[model samples]
Target: MENKNIIITGTSRGIGFELALQFADAGHQVLAISRKMPKSLMEHSNITCLSIDISDENEMEQVEKFVKDSWSNKVDVLINNAGLLVNKPFEQLTTSDFEQVYKVNVFAVAALTQVCIPFMKKGSHVVTISSMGGIQGSMKFPGLAAYSSSKGAVITLFELLAEEYKESGIAFNVLALGAVNTEMLQEAFPGYEAPLSAKEMANYIFDFSLNGNKYYNGKVLQVSSTTP
Candidate 1:
């Protein structure tokens, strides 16, 4: 990953935070984006923090322009790790909740990718963070209809994008994370126990990014700490 420049969304906390740190530790220049800035992240020469809401088109475009201008048309990776979740029975979920989740979880990923695509050089990997629920619905869970549906849409978009760019040297894949201890999950399941920590999930994602290959392109991987 030498000379790689990574733009990671949702970096204020959780797996996004850890991923940004890992990328910086690996000596790759990282552009960390989040709606709110983290007060405690240690300043690093390789890391540049940008405040931008993934759902905000104008702000995201500003990020794109900054990357293009600063890096000279080189965006090594675009990680769509921002997401939203609202748990409630399908009937209890409001139309506003559905629209909100879709805007950030699905639309932002697509829009941000499109903004970065023109400047992405060869061998760039586009990784989107989805969830296990996207692959197989969890019948036992409540209020995940909108979230799961949005993640499923992201997976489908990644697959289509991979097919479209297969001959163009860019790779696309979705990491369908399972039960990571992030604030989003905490909001959905107030008393739920998390099976994995955000740092652990972030490590797995960084490792997966390092192993990019055409064979794994278009695939959705279920990442769990206890899984083989």
Candidate 2:
């Protein structure tokens, strides 16, 4: 494939980090966004690291500017992979906790996608990382009221966006992942070993983001091997 301009959020570690490295290694230009820039990503010539809180609206403008000035107003793929998880019992969870999680998981995804839409042309793909917990009929867990709900919200958001933008020929899809042994997972379920590693899941997402649009649109794929 020819070199494409790709943007991914939450690249400081885990699947986001692996996705950035994998795409860059494949000769694609990558704009990796995270709260902190990873040293390894900085060393890669194909990757450009941006340290900015996605929840901050003012800071998000920087992404648009970069796309216009640096990427020359072109974005082939956008991965909304940055997510915030708050693990607290329903009784103990505060309103602030819900806001915090939604700010990053739902609002940021919407904001970032809006900013990049102008630059994304026909055949471009927007992939949002969701959780199986977000699915309506999927199993639910304790202490995930806020986190799981926010993931579900984004799933619906992307589905609506896909239909709204169908005429534009840009595809929007959601991947509801089960477990992938990332830092977030450890926090949610301590000592639980996931069957898939970060790199393994990233590899799947990498390919899906590139070609899944051709076969599916406004759809949610359940990427999981285990229950809960």
Candidate 3:
């Protein structure tokens, strides 16, 4: 790596936090954005932790300011890892619940990417994390209605973006992740052990974030060992 500038959202904990650590350790200019401050993330000299809820459109402006002042308004890699999962049955799920989920998982992705597009030049990659539940090889688990739908939209959004920005040199892709043993997974499927840990998932995500788009464009990769 050539000391690239990297931006990773949802860095409060789990895979997002791990990604922030790896990038910072590699001597990259890493910006870790989340709603709350992660103490470990704040300690790294190469990592800048910004506490901003992506669902709030106004807060994304802070990213614009930070990029302008610190990175000269240019970024090499952008990891859109922030997500909100609404674990509720279809009958129990209210319209508000779905809206809230979309606000974070879907709309916020577009909002943040829009704000960051001005900073991205050629060879820049946009990697957004999706879920297997939204695509094939997924079991359509209970309480994942809103979550799966949002992820499905994510898959489509980046696919479209890949074409829209093809001439601009911005590569876009989605990683439809499986059950990583993160807090979110545990909350959804209590007492169930996932096949992979957050660190394990982070390793794969880090690799894809770096070079997966070199050959593939408008792609959605279902990252998991388990099959239906």
Candidate 4:
């Protein structure tokens, strides 16, 4: 993976940060995009941090252009790892919450993937960060409709993208995480315990990215602490 150009979103912190560091440690040139860059990551030699909001259309265009021009229009791997969550009853959930969640989780992924398709070479991979709530109904939780539905849509997007790009040699998949001890989770469910660390989740994603196969493409992987 040395010299490979990898692009990841939401790298300011949490799982995205861990993934960026892991790839950089492995000698890959990383382009980390987020709204902000942590001071600790400013000194990473292998990483180039770009501050851009994925939810903004114009910013996304600029990011796409910068990536293409700087990287010679080539991206080895693209990871759509940015997401949002809102908790409240249906009646209490405002319209802005729905729009914001969908914009970040669903719209951004679709737009970025579409723009990245032409830049990706054969054997390149795209990974989306989804949630286990995407697979099953989250009746136990309140006000998860917007988030869960967006994840479900993300899974569907990956399915269509995998089939559409089958001959193109660009693999696409979604990692449906159970509970990662990330800020997003903490913000959504305060006091949640026994969650996976960003490094643990990053490792899982790293392995999958290296070993992506036909069977995994378009498939939603439900990651949890206990599995059969």
Candidate 5:
């Protein structure tokens, strides 16, 4: 495969971090965005680390400018991997909690995609990382009302976008991930061992982001070996 310009959010750690490294190792030019910058990502010659809160409009504009100025207004792949999860019971969850989770998980995905679409051409793929909890009829979890609902919202959002942009040939898809042994997972399910590690899940996402579009568009693939 030819080297392509890729943008991935939430690269500070976990699956996002692994994805950044994997893409860079594969000779892709990567723009890694996260609220916190990891030194390892910065040290990579093939990766550019941007420390910014994706929920902030100003910070998102900076990403647009960087793409326009540095990437020659071209983006081959965009991975919306940043997510915020608030583990609180529905009764205890405050409005602020919902806003915070939605800001990062749902709104930020839409905001970043809106800005990057113009730079993408035919064959470009936009992959949004979601959670299995978001899928209807899937096993529901407690204390994930905000997080799971936000994930579900993005799934529908991208499905709509895929159809709207079908003529443009830019593929949009969502991957509803199951339990992965990441920090986030630890927070949600303490002491429960996940069958998959961060690196393992990242490898799957890395390959899907590159080639899944050829077979699917506006589709949600449940990428889990076990139920959450």
Candidate 6:
């Protein structure tokens, strides 16, 4: 494949950083957006790490400006991987928890997409990462009601967007992945061991974000191990 312009959120570490590294290694220019730019991502010539919190609605304008001014007003692949996971039972969750989680997981995805889609054209791809917990009975965990629900909202947003932008030839997809060994997963489930590592999950996610839309758009792909 030819070199493509890519944008990824939550690139400070874990799957997001791994995805950026994988893409940069393959010669693609990646705009890595996170709260802070780590030296790991900064060292890559093909990677430009933007320090911005996607959850903050106002910060999205910075991304738009950077894309237009620095990288030209063109983006081939947009990945919404930044998310907030608030682990709490439905009964203990307050409205504030819902607001915070939804802001990062759902609203941020929608906001960033809105800002970036203007620069994208036909053949562009948008991939938003969701979780298996978002799917009913997919990961039967006690806590995380708010987090799971927020992820579900992300899946719905992209599904509608795919239909609305089908004529534009822009593909939109959701990857409802199972637990991966990341700090976020560890925080959510203290001692539970995830079946997949961040690197393994990043390989799958990076590939799908790059090419899975060739066959279909607006599909929520459930990625998990066969064994429970």
lDDT of 4 by residue, 1-228 (tens): 357888899898999999999988888888898999987566898898888888987787876787778889988889999888887788888889999999999999998888788899887889899987787653335668899889999999899989988888888988888877888887767887645788898999877876665456777777777321
lDDT of 6 by residue, 2-53 (tens): 8999999988888998999999999999999999788989999999988987
State each model's CA lDDT, in order: 0.83, 0.95, 0.89, 0.84, 0.95, 0.88
lDDT of 3 by residue, 51-110 (tens): 998999999999999999999989888999988887888899999999999999999999
RMSD of 3: 1.2
Q: For every model in order, what is the number of clashing pairs?
A: 1, 0, 0, 0, 0, 0
lDDT of 1 by residue, 1-228 (tens): 366888898888899999998888889988888887676544877888888778878778788778767888788888999888888899888889998999999999999999888888667889999987788654335678899899889999999999998887888999887777788888877776688889988888887776665458888887754421
List the candidate 2 regions with Cα displacement exceeding 4 Å. none
lDDT of 5 by residue, 1-228 (tens): 899999999999999999999999999999999989889899999999889999997789889999989999999999999999899889999999999999999988999999999999999999999999999899999999999999999999999999999999999999999999999998899888999999999999999999999999999999988976
> What lDDT score is found at residue 213 in candidate 1?
52
TM-score of each prediction: 0.93, 0.99, 0.97, 0.93, 0.99, 0.96
Instruction: Please report the TM-score between candidate 4 and the true structure.
Output: 0.93
- Show model 4 residue runs off by greater than 4 Å: 137-140, 226-228
Positional deviation of residue 59's Cα in model 1 after best superposition, in angstroms: 1.7
lDDT of 6 at 54: 88
Return the number of clashes found in candidate 1: 1
Model 2: which ten-residue window has the lowest total lDDT? 219-228
